[model samples]
Target chain A: MVETKVSKSQTKSTSQLEKPPSLMRGLMLSKITSWVLFILLSVLAVVQLLPLVWLFFFSLKNNQEVFNLSPLAFPTEPKWENYVTVWTQGNINTYFFNSVWITAASVLLTVFVASFVTFAITRMKWKWNKLVLGLFMVAMMIPIHSTLIPLFSFYTTIGIMNHPLALIITYSAFNLPITIMILLGFYYTLPREVEEAAIMDGCSVHRLFFTIILPMTKPVLATTAIINMIYNWNEYVFVNTFISSDRFKTLTVGIQNFIGQYSTDWGAIGATLMISIIPILLAFFVLSNRIVEGITSGSVKG
Target chain B: MLYDFKKKGEHEMDKVMSDKKVILLYVLPALILIMTIVYVPIILTGYYGLLKWDGIGEKTFIGLDNYSKLLTDSMFWKSTYHSFLLAAFSVISLGAYLLVSVILSGKIKGSNLFRKIYLVPMLLSSVAIAQLWMKVYHPTNGVMNRFLLSIGVENPPLWLADTSIVLYAIFLPIIWQYAGFYILIYYAALKNIPESLVEAARIDGASPWQIAYKIKVPLIAGVIKVTIVLAVVGSLKYFDLIYIMTDGGPNGASEVMASYMYKQAFRMNDFGYGSAVGFFLLLIALTVTWLIRKLTATKEEVQY
Candidate 1:
C-alpha cells in the first residue's frame, strides 16, 4: 500500500545515514548528563504528586493543628471522623449516590450506543455511512457552552428540567462522538470472518452483533467504558447550570456548594475532595494502560 | 450444482448482513439524539444571541444588538484576552512536557508509574482540584506560603487574592492537571519511532540532543499539532476550575470566556448578553481549531 511505503521511506533516511561515531561521543555520553535529566524528571513527578499528599495531611488535621503545625507534617492524632461527619451530616451522601447511579446509567448508555454506531459504520452496509460518522466526529468540535443555553431552555420547555434524566441524557449525547471514535478504531480492526460465519449459520444481524462481534471487542469496550465513567463522574458545567435543587446535584456541583457551606472547615473540605476522587484513583491504579491508549487514539487522529 | 447452491447461500447471507432496516435501527438512535441534543442547540445558541429577552420571558427580536454591544464591551474583551493568554501559556508549556516525555521514553525504569502519578490530578473533578488548590494557595496556613517562609523569603505575596498574580497562580494547577496527559501522549509518540532509526542516528555523529530535536520531534509533528488545537480550544472553554477556584475573582482578573458567559447568564440575569458571549466562545473555539490545523497541516503526510 502507498501508506506503508510512505512510512518506510520516511524512516529510511534515518536508517541509511549511519557512520562510525567520532571521539567526541565519549564526553557527550558522560553519566552526569543523563543523571541530570533523570533528576529533572523525578522532580516533575514529585511536583505532580505533592499537592495530593499535602491534601491528605491537611485532611487529617483539625483547625488547631492546621493553624499551628507545619503544612506537610502528619497530625499527632488522625481525625478520620472528618470523613464520617461529611458523609453523614452534610448532603454528601445524597450527592455520592446520585453520582454513582447517574454515572452508571450514562456510561452504559454511551458505550452501548457508541458500540451500535461503530458496528453499523464498520460492519453493516450503508450508503451514507461516512457522512454520518463525519457528523458525529464534527460534533466533538462544537463546544458544550455553545449548546448550553438552548439545551437549558429546551429542557425547561419540555418539563424535564432539574431531573436526573436531564443529566443522563446530556451525558450520553455529548459523550457519543468520542466514544464512537474510540470504538471505531477497534471495530475496524475486528475481522469480518466471524460475523460472516454467523450470518452463514442463519444468525440474525442483531444476534450477529450482540453475540459474535460484541464479545470480540471487550477490551476496547472496557477502554471506552472507563473513559465515559471518568467524564460522567467529574462533569460540572451541565449539572451546575441545569440542576437547581440540593438533592439531585452530583459530587462536582455538590462539593462546590458543600465547600461553600463548610468554608472555614479545611479538614472537612479536604476529606470531601479525597472521597470524591478515590474511585478514579483506584480505577487508574487498575487501568492506566487502557486510559493512556484510549486518550491517545481518540486525540491523535483528530 | 453443489457449487452453485453454495454460492447462492453466500449471497443470501450478504443480503441479511446489509439489511437496511437493521442498519437504520443501529445508527438512528445515536444520530437522532445527537441531532436534538447537540447540533440543534448549537444552531439555537446562534439564534438566541439575536433576541433581547430574559430566559423566562417572551422573546423580542433585536437583530445584532447584543453582538454590537459585545464588540465594544471592555469586560468581554478583557475576558477574551485572559482566555487567549491561558491558551498561549498552555501551548508554550508543552515544550517542557515534550522534554520530560523524551527523557522518559529513553528506556527508563518505572516510566509507567511516573506517568500514572502525573495523571492523578487530571482524574479528580475540577471542583475537587480547585478546592485542594485553593488550600495550596491559602495566604496564611497554605503549603505555598509555608514553603516560601521556610526558604527565608521576606514576603510571600497572596496568591489567589492578588489580581495581577491570580491568573498565573491558577495556571499552575492547569499545568499540573494536563502535564501528564501531554507527557503520556508525547511519550507514546516517541516510543513509536523505530529503534533501528535511533540506532542508525547513534552510529552517526549525532548526540542525544540532535537525535531528539532533529529526528524525534519532526516525526511526531502531527501529534504536536493535535495537542496545540486541544489546548487552545480547551482553554477557550475554561470554566469549571476558574469558576470553582476564583469565580473570576480579584475583580475579574481571571475571567475567561466561558466563565464570563456563565456570570452574565446566571449571575447578572442577562440571558441575551450571555448567549452572545457563549456563541462567541463557540466561534472562537472553532476558528482557532481550524486555524491551528491549517497552519500545522502538511500536504504530504509526515509518515511514521
Candidate 2:
C-alpha cells in the first residue's frame, strides 16, 4: 500500500512537470527567446560599429560626395585620393612618427622605473616602502587639472616646453602610480623562494632584480607597456597644452585642426580619425586579454 | 668551516652596505621624479593660488581674494550644483544599469560577447566617444532625431542646443561610456558569489528578486561601495566629454566645475580665480570621498 502511494505521488509530480507544455514546447520557447536576444545584440553591435563605419565610408568619399549624399549611405564612388591627400596635407605622417617615438619612450621609462620601485617595495626590506606606497596612492587621487597650470609654468621654466622627451617624462611620471600598483600586485604574487635562493647564491639586489624578478614579471610589464602606450598615444590635454608647434603636435591635436573655423570637413575629419585610431585598435586587438586582466586587477583594487 | 664562512660573509655584507649604498641609489631616480612631478606640482598649485598672475606674468600677493570671490561667483556655484546633479544622476542610473547588466550577464549565453560589446565605449578614447555622440545628437541630420521623427514624433528637441535638456543629454553619453565599466565590476563581484547559495535559495522556492536582494546584494556590498566611490570621483572630474561635445554650453547650461575652471584658466586667463575653483573642486572631491569611505566602513569581513 505504501509503495503504491509513493508511486502514485511520484507519478503525479512527474505529470505536473510535464504538464506545462511538452519538453519540445519549452525548448521552442527558449530557442525563440535566444534568437530574439541574438538579434537584439547584433543590432546593438552594429550601432556601436556605425561610427567607425561612417568614418571609413567618409574617408573614402570626397568632400562634395560626403555633403551631397546621404551621410548614412555608401559613396557612389570611393575617392582613394582622399587618403593620400589627408596623409600629405594633414602632416599626419610626422604626427604619427612623433606619437610613436613619444609613446615608446614613455612606455619604456614608465615600465622600467615603475618595476624598479615595485621590486624594491615588494621584494626588498625597506624602511620607507609603506610610505612610498601611500604616496603613490595619494598621487593617484590628485586630479591632473589642479596641477596643469603650475606644471605648465614649471615646464616653461625648465625650457622643455615643446620637447618630446619632456612630454614623455611627464606622461611616465603621471602613469607610474597605477603601473607600480599593477606590477606590485604581480610582483608580490611571485614565489619568495626564488629570490631567497638568488640571494643565497650571492646575487646582489640589482642583479637579482634585473635577471630574475623582471623576467618572471614580463607578462605584467607587457600589459603596462600596452596600457601606457595607448594612454600616451591618444592623450589630448597634456599634448595640446605642452606642444604648440605644427611639427610637434600629436595625433590628437593634429586631428583637431581638421575641424577648422567655419565648417568642419566631415570627410577629412572622419578620415583623420580613422587613420589615427588604427594603431590603437591594432594594439588593443592584439593585447586584449592582457588588457582585460590588467584593468580588472587595477580597477577592483582601486 | 661554517663559522669561518659566516664571519667572512658578515664582513662582506658590511663592506657592501658601506660602499654601495644600494637601496638609496636604486630608489633615487623614482624618488626625484615623484618629488618633482607629483609633490612639487601639488604644492606649487596651492602656492600659486595665493598669487595673481597670468601664464606669462610675475605674481602679486592676493590674500583670500580669490576665495572670497569664489563665494559669490554665480558661475562657480552653478557649476558645483551641476556637478552634484551629474554625480547623483550618474550614481543612480549607473548603479541600476550595472545591477541589471550583472544579473543578465549571469544567465545569458554569450555573456563575454556582450561584455566585449559594451566595453567598446570604455576602450575608445573619450574624444572619439564624444565626437561620435555629437553626430548622434546633431539637431537636424542626427540619427537620434531622425529616429524620433521616424517613430512619428512631429518634433525632436535639440539635444545640446536646448539649455534645459542639454545637461541631461550630455549626461547620457557619459553614462553610456561608463556603465559598461560598472557592469564589469558588478559582474565580477557577482561571479565571486557562491553558486551553492543561489541553488539553495532556488530549491527553497525563493524568487529571483528575493535571491538577488537577500543573497547577492548583501554579499557584494564591498564592490558596490567601491563602484559608488569610483562613480562619484569620475563624475566630479568629468571634463573631456563635455568639453568636446558642447564646450559647456549653448549658454553655459552644461557647465561643471572642471569645465568652468578650464575655461576660466585657459580661455579667460583668470589664473587667480581658476586656481580658487581648482582648490574648491579638490576640497569637494576629497570631502565626498572621505565621507563615503567613512559611511561604508564595516567591521564585518566579506568572504568570497
Candidate 3:
C-alpha cells in the first residue's frame, strides 16, 4: 500500500514536470520539493517572530488574563493604558529622552571624526598612513571587557565617571573603528578630481573637505550614522557603569531597574520593554535597506 | 584642460596633499581619543593586574600575585570553561546558519522579506531580549511551561533557575539573537558568487546539493573563516544578555568570563583581581583569533 501511494505521487509529479523548460527553470526544484522548502522557510520565519508576537499580546493583558489564558491567545481588549502607565509612572520618559540625545550626539561625533580620519588616510599622502589605518582596524578586535576596569578608574580620576560625557566619548571612541571601516571604501572609490580641482583653484583643504567632499559623501554618512545610532542606542554596559544617576540612565539600563519594581506586573513590564524597542523598530521599518547595506558592507570584506 | 599644467600641477598637488599641519589637524582628535580610550586603558588593565588595590585605595604593587591566583581560582576556571562552552556552541551553530543561508539565497520567493523578519531580533537591545526571554522562561507562568503543561506533562524544568539546564537555556536566546546576523552574512556571501559559475555546474548535471557543497562553499571559504573568527571571539566576549538574564547567578551556574570579571570588580570591589581576569580575557581573545587565522590559512585563497 505504501509503495502504491508513493508511485501514484511520483506519476503525478512526472506529469507536472511536462511543463515548458523555462517554467521548470524558474521553479528551480520539482513542485513537491519546492513546496517543502517553502513550508520550512515559513516555519522558520514564524519561530523567529513568535516571541515578539507573544510579548505584544502579553503587554495588553492583565495578570489574570496572562496567567489564565492560553499563551498564544490574544487579549480581548488591548490595554493601551499599560503604555500610558509605564510612561508616566516610571522614569521612562527621562530614559527615552536620554537615549535619543545620547545616541544622536554619539552618532554625530563618530561620523564627523571618522570622516575626518578617513579623509586623511585615503586622500592625504602621508607617512604612517598604513600604520594609522591598521591601528583603527585592530582596535575593532580588542574586547571591551578588557578595557572596563582601567576605564572605570580613568573616568574616576578624570572626575567624569558619573557624567554623560563619559558615555558619549566612550561610545564614539569604540564605534570609530567600524564607522571608519565603512567610510574608507567609499572614500577610496570617490572621484578625487573634484577635490583636486578645488585644491588647484586655491580651495583650502578645510574648505574642500567641508563643502565638496563632505557633501558628496552624504549617502555613506547616512549609513554610518544609522549604524552608529543603533549601536549607541542599544548599548548597555557603558550606561550601566558610567552613569549611576537616574536622570542620566538610557533606556537599556533604566528599564532593567524599572522592571524590578514591578516584578509581578507582567503588563507593565511588557509595556516598558515594548517602549524601549519601538524606536529601533521604527528605524528598521523606514531604513531597513540602509541598515542591511551598512551591516553587510561593514563586515563582509573583513 | 588641467592636463596643460599636469606637470607643474603634480608638484603643487603633492605639496597640498602631504601638508604636515593639515594631516595632523584632521587626524589628531580621533587618533588621541582612540589612544586614550582604547589603547591606554588596555595597557593599564595589564598594569592594574599587578597591583592589590581596591578601586578607591592606594595601590601596593604585588607583581604576578593576581595572575597566579587566576591560575588557581576554581571559580575563575569554571567561568572560563563556561565561556569556551559558549564559543563551541556558537561555532557549531554556524553550520545551521550556513545551511539556512544556502536555501534562502536560492531562488526562493519572498527571500528579502524573510531576511528582514529574521533580523528583527538582532535589532532589539540585549536588555529587552533578556527581559523578554525571562518571561518566556518564567517557570510557573511562562510560555514554555504553559505549553508543556497543555501537552499533559505534569512538570516542566525550571529553565533559568536549574543550574544544569541554565547554561543551555541562556544559549537558546543567544542563538535566537544571532541567527539572523550570521544568516545575513552567509547569504550576502553566497549571493556574491558569480551566477555563471552555478549555471555552468547546472549545465554539467550537478544536483543543487552537490553544487552548494562543491562549488559555492569552496568559493566562499574566505568568508566562512572570517565568520569562524567572529563567532569565536564574539562568544568569548559575550556578556550583556547573560549578565542581564542570569547575572551569573543561582550559585554561579551560568557565570562566563566577562560577567565574572564584572562581578569581581564592580560588585565585589576586587579591582586588582578583576583586572587580572580582564587582562587574561584579552590575551585569550587575541590568541584564539590569531590561532584560528593560522589554522584556517589556505595555501592559495580560492578565487573565481
Candidate 4:
C-alpha cells in the first residue's frame, strides 16, 4: 500500500519535472529522508517498550543482582522461582483468579446488554430513542470521581459493599457507553435485508436477535469484549473503594498491598506486577487489531 | 423496479421491529442500569455535597456549608491547581505526539508494528504502570539512579519522594502512558487524507513541510480539536498513577483533584467535603468540554 501510494506520487512529480538529473537526485534525497524518519520511529518504539523489557528482566533477578549488576543485564541464573513463589505463597494467586472471573463476567454482561441497546436504537423505532442515546453518550464524559462518593455510599447502604457483584455491576454500567458507541457504528451500517428477510419468515424477536443479529455481529462482539476485558482486568479504583477483603480484591489493589508488605523484595514485587498484567498482554497479542479498531472507531467518530 | 411490494416489506419490518414491548425489553435494561448506577448517583453527588456526614455516621443538614467551605479550602485550591497544571502540560505535549504521528504517517517501514509497540504501555493497568515506574524511581536501587550514577553523576535527585519535584516526576510516566493513544488517533486521522491532494502538492514543488503545515494540518483541524478536548479533560481527572506512585505523599506535593477527593472521602472520612470536590470536578469537566468545542467550532470544515 505504501509503495503504491509513493510510486503514484513519484510518477506524478516526475511527469511534471521533465528534468531527469534533478528528478533522480530528488528521489534519492526523499528516500534518504524516509529512512531517517523510519529510524527515528524505530527508536521511539524502543523507548516505549524498554521499561516493560526491563521489568521482565528484573522480575527474574534478586535484589542483590539488580543493585550490583547493570539495570539492563540478564540474570545469570534466571529466577523462575520468583513467579512460582509469589503465585503460590502470597495473595497474588487469589487476586489473579478474581481478576479473571470478574473481568470475564463484566465483559460478557456489558457487551450483551450494550448489544441489546444498540440494536434497539439503530433498528427499532421509539419516541425516546434520541434522548436515551444522548444520555449514554453524555455519561461517557462524567468523571468517575463524581460518581465515586454516591456509588460508595449506595453500595454500603445496599449491603453489597466489598462484594464481587458490586465490582461486576459497576464495571458493566460504566462500560455500557463505549461498548454501545462501537456497536452503534457497526450496527448503523448493517443492511436491513437480513433482518427483514428473517422477520418475513415469522421469526420471533428473541430468535431474530439471537440467531440472526447476534451471530452476524461476531466481529464487533469480539471487539467490545476485548476492550471491556482489558478495562475490567486493570480496574483499580472501584475494587480499592469497595472490596477490602484479601480474598475478594482484584490484582490491582491486591498487588498494591502485596508490594507494601514485601517492599524490599524487588523480585517478588516485579513478579506480582507481571502476573497482574500478563492477561491483558496475552489478550493484546491475540486480538490487537480488533482492540485498535474498537478504540479508533469508538473515539474518532465521536 | 417495484415500489408497492418494497413499501409493504418496509412497513412490515418497521411494525415488527418497533414493537413497543420488544423495544422496551431491549433498551430498558441498559437504561435502568446506567440510571441507577450512573445517572442517579450523578445527581446524588450534588445533594450529598449539602450534607455533613461521615461514611458511617448519621447525616446532618449542612445546607451549602460544605460547598462554601470548599470555596475557602487551600488544599482544595492547590489540588485544583495541580489538575489544571497537568491539563496545561498535556495540551502542550500534543505537539510532540503530533510530530511523531506525522512522521509515522509517511511512507515509513514497520509503521504498523511501531504504533502497536507504542501502545503497549497504554494496554497495561495504571496500577501496574505505577508499580513498574516506582521501581524505576527507587532511590538506591532504581533504574533511574543507577543509570545516572553509571553516567558519572555525583548525586541523583530523589524522584517521588522529593515534594518539590514529585508532581513533575509523576508526569513522566503519565506522558509515557498516553503518548501512544494520542499518536494512534492522529495517525488514523492523517491516514484519512486523500493521497491525490498530497501528490498534487508534491507536483507543484511544495516542500514536505509546506504540504504538511499548509494543507494537511488544516484538513485535520477537527480531529486536532477533538484530541485537545480529550487531553485536557482527561488530565483534569487523572488519578491512578499518582495515587499509586506517591499516594499524594511527601506532604501532598502530588495531590491532583481526583486523588485529593479520594483521600478526603475514603481515607479521612470527610465525605461532605469530598462530595463537594467531586461535584466541582463534574462542573469543570462539563464546562471545559463545552468551552473547547465552542472555541474550536469551525464554520466550514475542509471537505475531501
- Sort the candidates on TM-score, descending order: 4, 3, 1, 2
The lDDT, on a scale of 0 to 1, for candidate 3 is 0.91
State residue A229's C-alpha deviation in candidate 4, in Å.
0.6
State model 1's lDDT.
0.87
DockQ, cand. 4: 0.63
What is the Cα-based lDDT of residue A16 in candidate 4?
59
**Model 2 chain B: which ten-residue window has the lowest total lDDT?**
B12-21
Residue A129 lDDT, candidate 4, scale 0-100 = 94
Model 2 per-residue lDDT tens digits across residues A44-107: 5575566667767877876677656666778888876766777888787888888889889899
Clashing pairs in 1: none
- Local lDDT at A80 for model 4: 88
Q: For each predicted model, how many residue pairs clash, with residues at least 3 apart or on different chains?
A: 0, 0, 0, 0
**Chain B TM-score by candidate, in order shown:** 0.95, 0.89, 0.97, 0.97
Candidate 2: where are CA atoms >4 Å away?
A1-47, A63-71, B1-20
Candidate 3 docking quality: incorrect, acceptable, medium or high: medium
Per-residue CA lDDT of candidate 1, range B19-104, in tens?
89999999988998899999998888888899986899988899999999999999999999999999999999999899888888
Better by lDDT, candidate 3 or 1: 3
RMSD of each: 5.8, 4.7, 4.1, 3.5
Which residue segments of model 3 deviate by more than 4 Å?
Answer: A1-29, B1-4
User: What DockQ do the predictions score, one after another?
Assistant: 0.53, 0.36, 0.60, 0.63
For B212-299, candidate 2 gives per-residue lDDT tens digits of: 7888888888878878887887788778888878888988899999899889888988787777787777778878888999999999
Q: Give the whole-model CA lDDT for all candidates, comma-separated.
A: 0.87, 0.76, 0.91, 0.89
